[model samples]
Target: MSLPTPLTAEAEDSAGRRTDVLVTVLAFTGIAVALVQTLIIPIIPHLPEYLHASASDAAWALTATLLCGAVATPVMGRLGDMYGKRRMLLVGVAMLVVGSVICALSESLAPMIVGRALQGLAHGVIPLGVSILRDEVPAARLPVSTAVMLGSLGVGGALGLPGSAMIADAFDWHILFWTSAALGALALLLVMLFVPESKARPGGRVDIPGAVGMGISLICLLFVVSKGADWGWSSGTTLGVLAVALIVLPFWGWFELRTPQPMVDLRASAHPQILFTHLAGVAFGFSLFALNLVLPQVLQLPKITGYGLGESLATAGLAMAPQGMVMMAVAPLSARVTKTRGPKTTLMIGAVTVGVGYLLIMVLMSATWTLILASCVVAMGVGFGYAALPTLVMSSVPASQTAAANSLNTLMRSIGTTTSSALAGVLLAHMTIDFHGVELPSENGLRAVLALGVGAAALALAVASFIPRHRPDAAVTPADAIAEKVGLRPAADAD
Candidate 1:
């Protein structure tokens, strides 16, 4: 099979420097966005007191950002594909800057939450960046850049925790946002100076109705998931939002199918491999985030609890830092595995490893070393699984749909994490214990949440087994034919 000619002449003219520099800048842009998301986590405990806000109210700072991200990501991605990545990158960075400035200056929860929502717009960068890679970079260099770009999700979040903690320790929490804002401004400048406009899709139209519908559906779904535990899962408000999501989701799907230019290509997503990849993305994201949400709580719980370690926030962040290293170390290996054994085999191995990690945690929760080892194992699995997922989705779908398809995949992953957060909250709430004269698990409930993670990973593993392991170099089949008709390029020529 012939690869696409090394970047088109016009593309080459636009990309004068080494494509790697541009790719690195794009990758760093994505990493900066991710860092904004997790950087605040380490500051959460202190924010409530500093802002004179209730803990529950302050927590919305995180939830609001996630909710907005879940709603805006697909819309922004489609718009990026339609308009231009360079323009959108600048817009997203502007949003991040404005949001960070607002967050930095805010003395109350209300303004802070609004700033965070604006920052959510930045989440579009990665999907758009991934699509841009296909548009500009040589095929030979694309894979490694793609891997690093994607790997930033885990690495950024991991590094942000410690980095943010260090900042919080040295200065006030406001400094964190100020630092992020500065970084975002730098990214915006880099993008404007270095990144070229994408080759726009001719006659492409924004799917306004589809975008609105999907946006509303996601907003409702994420709202229920993010707020369910706080609002009472079975309460009228929670149930009402959930009911709206259930009704709107099918209609959104229907609308996407009927639209001339759907926000996301529903038909493309319906492909079996694509569908499975999405499902696996959801599970993997849920399980991976479970660790992020729970590990700190587990480590920081007062030692009065039978299972507590009582570490401080900085220490907890440090403890989890190693997992990021493991993830980075394993990512290239995962790419090689995909190249040799195909995405399915790599995915299956990753899922099984994740499940085994969770099982190890469940069975051996007596000491800190066990938790550290379990985290490393899970990170390795996540690195492998995360690497394979985009490869599978990108390979299965047409290149034309890469941004939308990957955005949708990213959306599913967010859905999984959002749902897991709610579920874990509920489980922990119900599983609190009274220990000696004090209440253990009352402040930070983790055991039940970790157990739920294990179950999710197991389910992910089971689903991974069903994904067909096609040879990476196999001849194009009927699916490839259909993809071509729908404007998708085959796997070998995908990037």
Candidate 2:
């Protein structure tokens, strides 16, 4: 065959512009999906009244979403690997739109819970987005693109809180879901218009049994972690679910190890570098969520409590909003550090920064501005840490396995956040001071949670330190090999 002609300067420029559009759209889609997580936080207190249900029943609106997201993350990742990442991503965003509409039109708890559960599936977008970047974005641009895309998690979550609060404060509560639906629809449209399908398919049949086993185990485990406090730690229901998860996990692993095309590659994950990266992901998750929990409580509690800031919910959200902006700002910086010192160093720095932020929070909780400053510090750490995680995973795994590996990593973080929420809840629940006739979380309890945040950051830093150092020239991943073969990279560089 005749040699394929190289692109002209104008064609290359057009390609560059397309790549930019792809990254921008993907990042926007990530932020839109993430918004679902915090959309209900502002209206949580009034959920029971709106649904005409008991408080315990209404809590399912939150719990269902968490459980669905946990179940969906790994399964969706596996499917994306088998099929097409962009196709799966579109499906995920579609679920968000449908779920949001269901929630918007709901008059009772059942439909609301269903809608939230559907929205949870959108969590898969982030991992799949990162994987797509690996497949399509030029290697030079990959780091910054992935960093910004990953940081959208923090961005959407931070912006959503105050935006949702302000909207809820002024309009009917249904407007929140309506707004979510609109955003999801817009993201879905933009994604279809801009993001290209990934070519790195590691052709494999779905591991049906493995998926089912893993899903059941995760659901049971996460359910217990998230609801154990309210259900009573010793309650049979909680213990039973916990027991099921514990029993199912070993079997799931055993089956996965034997399967030729496993839903999750246990061997790859067990490698020290990938394993440590995952452990660090958990630590980062705990730190991020713990900060989310403690800061808001400290900000919104009655001012009569010596430690509380006594701000309204909207104001508290606005104060926290700067952290999201900081995270976005730190993304490019994270990419720079990853490019220079390596992702391991980036993660370590992030861990240290996060620890310092938590320390600041402990000392600075008395004032809103101080708390904002401390949260911004934590956001910086989270941005750096989140950006580093996928880069590390992608570097180690084959291009074909990126989505699955990244999904598992994301799942680890979810587990960490869930554990943090549980621990913080228990501490705040038991350590409360009487404010008039009601009990409120005591300063000591909140302080303990903040201390745990510090401990989590330290744990992440320690775990990240153990990750094997990456030398760009020393490793050629499957993706790199493919890119080289396909002329996506210069042959000299490939060698």
Candidate 3:
């Protein structure tokens, strides 16, 4: 046997290098998508004045993103499954870049809302990136890689808060979107260069009826949840919309079950493992967003209110920034736990950790350090929970259906977050302290919100406990072996 030349050795090294590039690119892509979620947070309060719109109209800047994201995630995921995951991912990123540029240049409500809605369409990027990772990365590297890639959601959102806050504070508000646009463009370029297209396309025509049914049902339901506070939760219009959702969802489920190549495989998804995982997602989402909503308000409100931290946006962001770091730092460890014990065990641990965080902070709401400590705890919980989800999902489904299955899981989280937003708004808005003739969230209200978070985490823990432990001969979708043979084990398979 002839020994290899140096040139040949370098060439072999490059092949190894490509894998790292692919994982890095996909992880950053996930982070960039998450950054878009929080890009406008610092400017949200002033949007009405900046855009010369009513507060309600200005609020659509946020709502548009949330609504569009909910609808687009599953749609894009299914499209990725049928066509190509990387192709859809690029398309999603392209929308974000374009949307950011539009928002960057806009000075009016209509354009800004349009831009934001466009941005929302790209929210599927995270899940698609996960799907892509599952398709391309080696099994030995998958768990840590999965943890890092999935952790981007928390890491990006956490960093975005402080990063955008400082940018908005220092420069024109447009800079926030411009920064997102630039980061998104970088992500796009990296993906094009590094990520390979998965050959596991589940080729078929999309189920249009099923898609439309799910869209309408989600839109109506989320609309009520997101808009009910502004629209008057008890108003006839709110009740009417809620009625529409209640009426439509059952029919939607029926259509999905009957459709060929359904957008969401209702029958497969009804498996206890997948079902309980998604159920936990809803509770996890609720617990996660409640902290974001309540913490910022608590940090920035006047200290005269007793519970308020009286911090500036920059300062509050600084205080809260540790959460993102904690999330990133914990990902590898979380992956380790999943590998050793099982994802179900990891998720249960995360749920308990998150519950403990909320419960601790409810009693320790006096100082900045305690808030930081509590936030980090919650972040750790998010890292563990988020990483476990993809594992749970990939295990339950086949490689060919990875994107669609994960997309559904992502959708469940959105539902939980949206519900959390509405419920928290009601709690904080109604429970108030009068300060200088203006009402602010009372200390009790903040504590109550924390209590609610504890409940949500506890709920997630309970649901996750019901997830069947992974067994040696556990079933996977028929496509798993093929995917593994093709060098991409779906979802960084459990150890």
Candidate 4:
């Protein structure tokens, strides 16, 4: 966390300007990428008619994006560490622009899926942006900058939903992609103009074979989790993929351990500080995503269902938008808590807040205002947890490993979210009541899912509690990291 103390006043002035530009551009880029993820949600059910495809076939549009993003996140992060973080960042955003254009122009299922896969490649931007800030920004501004950047993940997705829903309602669905393309282009221009390439490049060739092995294993594992309900969990195809993942993962771990430049450093990951933080990431992710699954359905279902409020898609989106604003508002608190109480305490507070929010949701979802209040409460917890996670990772690992390490942490959250989606789908499908000719999720089923969310948040709090206390020397500068181990932070002071 040490700095050069700005050898001269003029140099300090220029440094301050660059720091401002860097933080601003990175936060905008994070929002741009996150917005693209949710932009397609409003149109998912109508995708079959829009592309003249079967319902099963149309679902691939969303599935493809998740798979591509899962694989691309860590791979691109490793590439960033080797080449340059800002360079890989630009490449990621460029893919988003290209993907948006393809989706905007598409008239068939194949092109839309391809475009989605391209958009997914941009998922690495958030982690890479954090890594770049670590390298280029001053120690004092680092915590706040990282909090703002991380909060953008929630902000972009929350805001995008209503905006995209409105666009789809008013115009051709293709207009949504066109709008996304325009935003991507704007982000590209800003990054190119303001963000500089990080000088903290690691020296090593990429572990091509290791990367391939890791990618294949992840694709299989996530495919089972994401599509098992549709594919029949016990079917041969699903069983075979599950079996392949189980077998391949162990071998992949073995290979990575032996390889000179591993895709993920197993030895380092095994450290308690990094390990518990990642486990917390998964649990925290699972807790937050249940809100997304439950709110939209309650808002859009038939009012005759008694429990359903019967709002339109656009209105449902608006109902959830406050969560983003809550996350943004909590960003500065994330910085303040981390600086004073230590990231471990901040993360613990977040997990408790998420648990309490879910406890309220289990009772308070009878009305829209109550639901929105519950969502905002959960989002405040997420902002705190998300901001603290990268801080913990960066503090624990060396500067050279920041991109790879943070990317892996992000992937862990994706795994949690995917699992939550699958779990909710199962609960709702089996626990349904007949309304007219259709079966719909019963109120009890929704409560069961919210109860699960509460459990996950509790688990996250438990995991966060296990993180080892930080020593004063936890964060070594990039220059210091080159010659020695990372610095550990001192015990927390009474700030």
- Each model's backbone clash number: 1, 0, 0, 13
Model 4 C-alpha lDDT versus the unseen true structure: 0.88
Model 2 residue 93 CA deviation (Å) reads: 0.2
Candidate 4 or 3, higher TM-score: 4
User: Which is better, 1 or 2, measured by TM-score?
Assistant: 2
Task: Tell me the tens digit of each residue's lDDT in model 3 across 354-460.
Answer: 99888878877788889889888888998899888888988778788889989999999999999998898899898988899998888888888888899999999
Q: Against the hidden reference, what TM-scores do the models get?
A: 0.88, 0.96, 0.93, 0.94
User: Candidate 4: where are CA atoms >4 Å away?
Assistant: 1-10, 472-495
Instruction: Tell me the tens digit of each residue's lDDT in model 2 across 311-333.
Output: 99889898888988888888888
In model 2, which residue pairs have backbone atoms overlapping below 3 Å? none
Clashing pairs in 3: none
Tens digits of per-residue lDDT for model 1, 1-495: 434344544444444355767877887787789899888887777779877899998888988889888877787777776777667778888999999999999998899999999999888788788777666665434455566777777777888888999998899889999999998998898888878777654438778888777877888888888888778878999999989989989998988888888888878777888888899999988988778877777788778775778888888888888887787678677767776778788888888888788778766666677788998898889888877777777677655666667777888888898888778777776768876666545433575677777788878778878776676755333333533544433345555
Stretches of model 3 off by over 4 angstroms after superposition? 1-16, 472-495
lDDT on C-alpha atoms for all candidate structures: 0.78, 0.89, 0.86, 0.88
Candidate 4 per-residue lDDT, tens place, 1-495, comes to: 343243444555766787888888999999999999899998988999999999999998998889999999999999999899988999999999999999999999999999999999999999999998898775556778889999888889899999999998899999999998999999999999998877778769889888888988999999999889989999999999999999989999999999889989999999999999999999988888889998898888888898898899889999988988888889888888888778898899999898889888878877889989988889989899998999999998877889999999999999999999899899999999999879999999998889889999899999998999884234645533322232222222312
Give the number of the best model, judged by TM-score. Answer: 2
Higher-lDDT candidate of 1 and 3: 3
Could you arrange the candidates by lDDT from highest to lowest?
A: 2, 4, 3, 1
| Candidates, ranked, TM-score | 2, 4, 3, 1
Q: Is candidate 2 or candidate 3 better by TM-score?
A: 2
Steric clash count of candidate 3: 0
